[model samples]
Target: MAIWNSRFKKSFDKSALKFSSSIDIDGKLFNEDIDGSKAHVKMLMKQKIVSTSDGNSILKALEEIRNEISNGKLKFDWQKEDIHSLIEERLVEKIGERGKRLHTARSRNDQIALDERLYLRNEIKNLLKLISDFQKVLQKCLDALPEQWNMCVKLKYLTEKSGEEICQELNIAPTNYWQIVHRAKLQLRNCVENNWFKN
Candidate 1:
């Protein structure tokens, strides 16, 4: 607040301050925010915008802040602006002058944007893993089917082929293709339900 007040004629209203605070909302983004800040520090050092020693100190203090937040030694105060300010404030407190350099080459909005992208990337990775696990379960069910049934399912669903193409590919008549597809459907459902749903 003191930093922000320097350019103002008078203090901002306290009620407006409470209304504008996003600390509680963005607190969950702490890990992403810390990660974004660390990356910023490294980039600044690489570009010579921030000295290596100063960046190192800021990084060290940020790591300490991360650990404290992780171990419940630090807590977010909703009265502050957001996680960016909170971390920056803590960093300045920890390493004094060096911590101020952490904000070089970035703004508060830039921090949240980077944090969100990193957070989304991590969540997307987790989603892909879950999809892979489900694919494994589905693969097991497909494997348990007869060879022709497996091929039928693969061509129709996995390969996104039409019934006519599938019949031509499998060298089966339309009636035979339908019969195999129906049986495959039943067997695959039973297999997945037995092996996947119960668990």
Candidate 2:
């Protein structure tokens, strides 16, 4: 296991000199990478490839490294080749001999591909939720305007414009527009509930 680890690390260090990482452009994969490592360690333990103690240690160390990177205590080392190498190097630094066991059965190729796919899957879910929320907010905004304002020629003109253009035309700051839109959505919900109960 140690020999395999040394060879892997050496290969990574050598490759680091040749390949520039996409992490600079797509660093959002950091969280997913960390999660993948956690799951991998669990699998390794289940297979008896690594001792439970070492597995737990690796998991804890990875979590600490993840938090450090996320909170800006650590910065990406672009010259370190890729995210997997960066993580492995950090683990070795943190856990000494035990860190060497973390990569027991995995190849860097599979590791990185898994991390990227998991990251993209999570990002898609988040984007879908955001779109749904935006639609709900838009519907609420439409329902909240007073009937006269809703039908007003000026309101129609503003609505037809892009949000940025509409905000600029109203002399409203972007933050103010967001706040108003959010509050209007909440009020619309309240109004609908009240009318439903009365009916």
Q: Using TM-score as the measure, which candidate wins?
A: 1
RMSD (CA, Å), each prediction: 4.8, 11.3
Off by over 4 Å in 2: 1-19, 141-199
Can you write out model 2's per-residue Cα lDDT over 1-199, one digit (the tens) per residue? 1124454534445454445455475466778788988898999999999999999999999999999888998787766556666777889999998997877788777777998799888889999997776666655655567643333324434567665775676767777666666655576667655544344
TM-scores of all candidate predictions against the true structure: 0.64, 0.60
Clashes of each: 0, 0
lDDT of model number 1: 0.86
What's the C-alpha lDDT at position 122 in model 2? Answer: 82
For residue 146, what is the lDDT in candidate 2?
Answer: 60
